[model samples]
Target: MKPRTLAGTCVPLCLLTAALNAAWAQDVPPGVGSESASRAGGNRLDRVELNSRQQSDTELRRKSQVAKQIYGRDELDKYGDTSVADVLKRLPGVNVAGGAPRMRGLGAGYTLILINGDPAPPGFQLDQLNPAQVERIEVTKGPTADKSAQAVAGAINIILKDAPRVSQRDLRLGLGYNVDRPTPSATFTLGEKLGPVSVSVPVSVFEWRSLNESVTERYAKGTDGQPSSITQQGEVLNWGHGFNTAPRISWRRNDDETLNFQGFAQKGQWNNRVRYNNSLPVGMPNPEDDADNKGSWRMLRGNLQYNNRFSDSQSIELKAGIQDARGTFNNLNLRSGLPRVHSVGDNQDRSLTQAGKYSQLLGEDHSLAVGWDLEWRKRDETRTTTLANGQNQLPDFDGEPFGARIERQAFFVQDEWEVSPQWSTYLGLRYERIATSSRGGSESVRNVSSVLTPLWHINYKLDPKGRDMIRASLTRSYKAPDLGALLSRYALNGKYPDSSVTNEELSPDRVGNPLLKPELATGLDIAYEKYMNGGGMFSVGLFHRRITNLIRNAVTLETPSFASAPRWVSRPVNFSRAQTSGLELELKGRANELMPALFDPKTALNLRGSVSFYHSRVDALEGPDNRLDGQQPWSGNLGLDYRFSSMPLLVGGNLNFTPGYTTRQTQGQWLDQSRSRSIDLFAQWIFNPKASMRLSVGNFAPLDGQSVTRLSAGDFTRTERSGRSWVGLGLELKL
Candidate 1:
């Protein structure tokens, strides 16, 4: 079915289901068929039945006071995914773009990513982390006082594996196919308890390769008002290998206090080669181009946490962390009838963090928490560009080291109150200040910003059992400008020579603005959630955000201090105000319960799906297509899993779709992206409880091609690019 028609049908159906469930929930007695009741009777029962991963995950979501979703081991191991990005793409209202996860169709920087409740380090790649190292994933739809208030769309927290009470060991081996070669990957996890200490370590090694093809066409008016056109065909080959490990240790000091240490390390290298052939209409010789790029990065971080419970109603926790990361990159480009250009760069980053939180219980219905967070980070980088003859490309900036420092401090207080058995509320206030300083050559720039944010959330149980509920939140969130955007530096366009004065709008030189301010937002969210029997759930949510000081790059022709002549330069600026709103619907349940007439009542079949619609407008830009950059109009996914009754086998598949959309970046510039569709399938053969094999196909269908177009008064340029897919086979062991 068409995406529009499907969206129209699904929204109404989801709302209807929520209404029916709410009505039915009122008649059911409190705790009649709840998980707590099933485990009642002094914690002793005639028979014990362990909850499945799905059931446990559902319960966690149902119990959360705020709107959140929990994905446990079941999701991590569902398709034998080697990367966390692959696993995240199937989540509801979430999508992966440029190796980063976007929430609610918003682009990167909108979703705040956290590791073990702490903000992830800069330059961290989610695709490099193995899913086997994760214990669970938590997705919160709004900002909370305990966490950083940088989430303008939402937050996703990656909880690494923790020490286990019982000794455990597991290993996984996999082989993947992409392009014309086969790649191998492996992961191993070990956990043990010794005396008063518990330790767990998970390590993974993986390799990947892909080849993408593209065709570019450009049309522009020459000096004589005649249109000149050029077509270029290009190919890029990329390959990489990486390894990462997360080790955790817990030391239990009696029943009232505990200490923990967690360490994470990752190292990786990637190489790519590019070649392009130009086809001109006039048979004129075009610049022959060939480029090679290589890069490597490494990170090491460690954290220590301490917890103390002075009394039953009071507790305190303290944490300290340190991180060091380094990277190196080199690139070489060769052009016909031109000098060969070679560039190399090195980067190093270091950070220190300290945080503390204290909680107190007020009477029996209210819990209050106060916390403080402090962090300091510094980055040092050096780059040199030279010709094959050993002459510096840019004399003023060559071989010079530049650096930036960021310091952040925050204080927050929150209270959670159980007003009554049927209602709960959260009230929080936070004050955060960020200071940044950048130095390049003889110029130094410093910026400081502070914000005070207030957040409120409330939940109402439709029935006494809490099977059906309503959640609403009013929050103030902000997106801070990154170090790169705040740095005052000049980066010349590679397509044209540095000494050339002529430049095109599509290939403009880039520069940063040290005066850019953070984007602040006021958000409202409302959701209705209904939990059904047998690990089923249905939720419909609506969200709206009013944003001020939106940051966007503005292009203009100018001659700066570093430039000798006028050139097109794109610099970051605080654009006009913008607003966005969306509707999200999610439904997951057993086929027998959701559609009894279409399937057998006892069939072991499960179904899950989600659809989201979004709309946005920038007040500074004129219509017809003045939406937010990279935000699609609609997106959805459908998935199913079936277990064979007569065999030890399970099969599942998922289909994801996002329609094409256009964005009017400026009055004279436009960008368009093609529709995207992906299909993934997996089959598992269970030999026993401890061993299994899985065969999976990711992006089974041909990859979707994308196109981008830039328009001017009499000039236009368009580029079309193709994609690739992969397949894998994996063996999992529990010993």
Candidate 2:
């Protein structure tokens, strides 16, 4: 699909001029270490700087609130993790549902991500960022008036490193190995100060490979539930590669005004191959099928933003970005030395966004913020199916040439006020409008919707020393149905009747419904926090949500759309109500301080952990249920870190676990999944001031896992087992 005409062409011109003006405004003195730091001296300086920064936790504590957790550079470096997703997994109330991270067990769409307080560009992937580029990460569990009110799960803000005030450059190279192949990565960054302007450019490349295996079992209808068929066995291999580049420029016209510009570009490619062998029941009259499938995808995204600060507490920001992504998938099924089917698909997606925000301090105790944003998205897909020797071609599915266009607009206003010396409050309002149109061959559909939301938050300091605080909030949020799920013109059916078909499945025959409405939610939050000395903190929070118009899949049997066979049709229908509530406890501090008598201060040890207990009740099409579609009941993480005072070494490990939750399909198929656990360990050695190496073990135990799905109608069941594990050793260098 091709996006609308670019609107950012003129924006860069304005920012470029500001950059030039700021550069001419400043008159800086001679370089401090730009000329003196040779390779040897640079190494020494790098070590000292890293150590100094690791000891500072003031930034994290300073920016945190009662319902938020902030992880800074020191926390990020503790485990030698590579991706933002990896670090978030160890945080409280976070779960890796599938390809994306979910907060409080909410779906990916319900969880919002922002870059520097601005909505992230479409198609943005968290794993694309290298830890070196991030200055801090903030996880907000409740709605805040100054930001968008679309988060049903919560919000995550990623703050990138700013341009350095002085001239410096770094080059890093790393090599490692996993279960499948060698992994290699590299990064380079350059920062320079030109008079009154400062600029930084960073580029990185990384690659990884994986090996996985799975086994499946299927049983036919029987009185005793004895297995009538052992369905299939499968093996899979995957490899992925990614590259990224980001450049920033900041210029200060004076103490009262400043301008900054940042640009980002990233590309990634993934490849997967799968092999499966199927078994046939005696005299079943069906041929035994052995299948081989392979797929690959490549994605590209770019974004840019400009910010102008008029004074210490007032500023205006403008941002414009574009995303273009395309990929293809192909599958060929064979049986008895004959090609039974060949299917191929080519898909493309493109999006563009333009946004602006204005903020000013009304006085010492009050401030106001307003913003407007607009976005356009489009997707195009084409599929072809050839049966038996390429001589027979099945007619294109109902929506063969599928295409869609979606446009959305939002405006918001917020006010922050201090009602008293120890009390503060925030009030905000937001309006949103969305329009979408889709077409497939001769069929076309369009829809439009709008909404208004209001929110409020209050905070109180219960102690004069500011060591104890309480927070409460009541807000409104919503989750819009996925564009693809609402506009896709046709149904894509999976290959059935060959393996576990009789055992009942959530048939992949998905077709979009044009009448879907967004799910609306009213939420409440309350929390108390105790700030300890040495930047430590202990907190407990409670949250609740009441949601309506819940969207879920509804299946129908014997649909004419697919030759009188069962169809897993997805129609957005409203549900009565769903309620969710959860409790969170977080503790982070030095062990010596928490338990002075049990630990020695000389050990230099710290502890960090969180526990979350949550549950939800929803009226499903099948019946009453206690779980929302993607949410888990409970989750937790624990980690311990020790810094050796005698040497430049740091070692840490973490354990994250979640108990599996089960659910029922609209068609009466029940799915039960087993618990999941992940363990990671890391050891880092700062060999020189500029050089370091890390050894990491991820999913170290190779834990066995299983899941079962049962169909009451057919009295059939299917089970699958798999394992995940890997290890890596990496080296870092700076210049």
Candidate 3:
């Protein structure tokens, strides 16, 4: 538990280290047959993770944060964040890649989101996650057969704070600003502990406006044609707002029985307006066409879990939850005298997910644990577009759009066995039955099938020094296509019109075979950790994964366009192979916590952080030799903070830099032209244990025209990083 005036690193280093060391010395790190006596602090902070160990685990350059591996809690509290994407960007080895992210070469459909390790409803976009209620985020990299057969892209577990153990309570309020936008954001949270039960509720709201401007020059035809058009520039305005709320409850009825639950709900919306204040080509609108779009998304989630004891060495556990998601986006583009185009998008998802987990202590020397999970979900999505007299984005275009739906059901179970005091092994299996259903008079489609997944893990302790240990795991995984990818079609006027969308007879864009096989990957990961006799810590590891049936949307340029259809268009195709590989390293330690009381107030402070280095390659692609856009190869995060018992205030910050890395090169070079190096800096000051403030600046080292900017005016669509620029401010509060 946090003190009235919080101070010290997030975790209790000394105690956690001792607990683990004691267990390691006895050949029982974590499993059955291990003594049940609590050795030290394991659970305390609500928004941070603590190792509890002082020696620290040094196996790779990448040190898992206080939260879970992959995804963690530090993202939310490190700064008062408003969007989920903003928080995910700071994670190591992860690059936003502009729109979203392609984890280990896996697409969005393969990645699944869970609140407290339970599957969320379908149709939910990653960008819509609410940051306010998140206590921490754990990313389970690589395949997991039981959690979600669809976890080929990895798993994101969002851990919400359970009610505190005290009857007392705490609250927080915050606001932030951006130069180009006048949007104001605020957050409030209250936590209370009442004997055997605890509860916490948090609410947040934000309203913002932004401006976007761009300039482009017309390049003549192949023969250095006549002077085409002078430099052209356009301006856009965007407005957006969002709402989020979370409620958590925890009950520890005595010591042997306990219950924990966390629920979240959110609503987000954005409006975009564009104005090309310039002239058009031949027979185009004078002041150029104008377009506006309105979009909104809402999500609701709940998690419930309970544990009880029947006797001294006997116990049972059960956990269950559900998630509902729905959203709509509308875009209208047209000019005064040109044919109008109207595009609307909508999606609704409902799911009933539950699981039964059990653990039984079998005798004094042997124990066994097993669990089962069940999930059923469905989603409906539709996109429509038509051409009127004039469209804001385009002048002439006539077409109608379509809709589609997908339904799925999955079940999984696993068991852990204690081979002996010096070693343990885990083995598990899971199965999923995916049924994709389609509607709207568009040839109903269905993918009714089942797949089997398996996993294995082993651990060993080589020495009593508690420094030498080895862990390894092998998991088989699968990725299923969503309803949108297989059966959804929208009339993208200029991009894809009647020529763009048609009957499934022809493979659609961004998808391989309508009956495409699930992508497969086998992961092999082994790591070793050791604590030096004296001080420092170091970790390094190597990783590689191969993916198959990679999906990509290919342009059908030479393929003649339908007479009544538009000019150019595209469709989906299967790319034979896609591979990803990389190496990682992380090192940290207390250079010296006690330096003979250097200052007046108290003992000397401690300092430390980690550095990661890696490279990624698309390996193979069947597309028109396009550059993997918006991806950086060499990127790293370095943080150094100090706590003071002397001064009334503390100062600290982190520096993150990413050298420009183009995953792949595009044909026209739009991505390459905008490609360049960029870095961000952040610093915080704690006036007292009760109040603190921080400033985060991105593109702080921006040069020329390389900075961060939202291209879609009000939406999250970022065109590219702009020139040297920054945004900063301060925060203050009292517990």
Candidate 4:
């Protein structure tokens, strides 16, 4: 059967919502999932007991010293998101394109990701995490003195659940089905408390599958209108699976000292099968190609921290951690029934960090904090390809077997002062230095960089009740070139020696620049917020950023090699300057407080909406009209949730939209994308105090991302579309 069109996909989700409303209009029991012939309803409980935990959390975030937003467990249940990336997509001004989260139109490199206030290791995959293991999520748009100065756009901190005060066991079982495939997931958690010690172990396994199709038209143009053509079409099947386990232990030695240790490990794999057929113009030759590719990755991390409380308002913390990650990829290519070629690639990364912090109360209205951080890292990467044809072996690129060593040190101090009853401010400064060396074969390069950053934030309350406030901040941040980019490396998979074939003569993989500088940015932020009772808030914020020494890909040389002919050597370079500015508006409150206020006193209803608009200009290859790479023009998020007072049922849904934008590529090419959208619907039943069941239809109307790439030389256009959607059912039980 053919897949449904976009319009056809929306009908079922709309009908589902309509059915829910029709049921609410009928006289039915309150708690039962079954339906009688006439009208089935749930029985009312004895009393109207309301728990406002979620509301209270929102209030706390609004009053935080720094500008921030929070998402609690209630929001998690409503959206039924499986991964941190999915959850972050619902926040204000966050973009998750191609399965990675971006903030304020900036890509992942500019946004810092943290776990429990510590930086997540490079190459850490957020999708491997189970949402059930999180207590809350905090999103800060700018860096604070306490955190690193690497976040140019913002930061996201994921706080995991703390050890239970009492012994506890939790089990979650989940099953999902796409129209084309089935998905299975499960998680188990057990916590134990023994006197002064507490420990918890959690494990999870998840898998998913998807299908994609693409078409490309290549044209050879001349001064005349007539053009020669080549058409290619392809389909790919992708499947992935992951298994993760984390164990944490905490020790409390009286009330003055504490120690905590945590360890995490995960293994993930992805497999893809591609089939393609190409048709050539009269004189040109075309062939059918097929390939099977598989990639696997493993990660391990350990953290240890000790905290000591010297006095009422004086404390110190020491932390140490290590993380290691490895990945491997293998592919077998078959072209036009020729001899098969096998290719292999490997990557390894190891990192260690040590940090210490001390905090003291200077006086009645001032607090000071000082911290130091040190990090060491090493990386190794290699790739190899072999052909089955007799006496047809080719030498690898010169930059194979790449390696890098890096070291970073930083020191920061911050002071928080409450000068008056209505005014509070924070002042801080940080100095950071980094040194790196890269070796490819026998050649090597080294680099060193240092920067000093200063940050300030001030908050002014207009009234004694703290109902209205103005916040402003100024900060500086930097983004360093990654290890792989600085280390010269290349892998030529399809090309071979002494081959004149046009299509197979594609460019060889080449890394050029061994010496690259970090990008720098200066930014400003101002916001106004109005707070209402019961955790309601309306906010408007504006921000501006000026970036210098923008890093962009540049072609350094074009030459033929023993392995691949007609190859280009490319490197990242400091190209130009860019300026970006935007505005954001957000609203969060109870549904009953929004329009008609129609819900019962005991019922829980919540609504949240956020929208962001931005524009950026960059001076680069595209001339003065160029915009920042991968920057979206606009994005928005909306959500609604309701829990009935007379029943054990909960219903909610969310929508996320990002209008597409286009960008120019390195080789006189341009790419365009259509608007993207994500919708999710969920209904949960609280069977009892100890057990619950949830049914969720995620990506209910999943957007079909259509990307078109146009080349200038041959006037070629490549169009591709990929879609993702699924339905899931889960059961949770506590003991």
Highest lDDT scorer: 1
Task: Provide C-alpha RMSD values for all models, in order.
Answer: 9.0, 10.6, 11.4, 4.6
| lDDT by residue (tens digit), candidate 1, 19-49 | 4356445543233365556334212211111
Q: For residues 1-735, write the lDDT of model 3, one tens digit per residue.
A: 111111121122233345435534554322223233211211121002222233222322123211124334434655545556666665544445433544433345555666666665654444544465676666655555447766664666666665655543344443333334335566667778777788888776767555555653332211132223333455566688887777888888878998988777888888988765444442321222467779998888787888898788767778777778888888776565344567776777777666765666666544455566665666666555555633322222122223444444555555555566546566667766666555443345555666777776665656644455565667667666655556434233332333433312122223223454566666665656444543444445455556566555554434332234323334454544555445555544443432324532222233344444443344453343232333344456565444432222233455555554333322222232334444544444443345555555544444433322221112111233234333434354545
**Which lDDT tens digits does candidate 4 get at residues 639-666?**
8877654566778888888887887645
Least lDDT summed over 10 consecutive residues: which range in candidate 4? 37-46
Cα RMSD of predicted structure 1: 9.0
Candidates in order, TM-scores: namely 0.91, 0.85, 0.75, 0.89
Off by over 4 Å in 1: 1-51, 221-227, 280-288, 336-339
Off by over 4 Å in 2: 1-66, 220-228, 279-304, 309-314, 334-338, 391-394, 398-400, 497-508, 560-576, 621-625, 714-717
**Model 2 agreement with the true structure over 625-700: per-residue lDDT tens digits:** 4467667778888888766543445678888887877866454766677787888887776665566667666775
Error of 1 at 666 (Å): 1.5
Give me the overall lDDT of model 3: 0.51
After aligning candidate 1 to the native by TM-score, how far in Å is the CA of 419 from where it should be? 0.7
**Of 1 and 3, the candidate ranking higher by TM-score:** 1
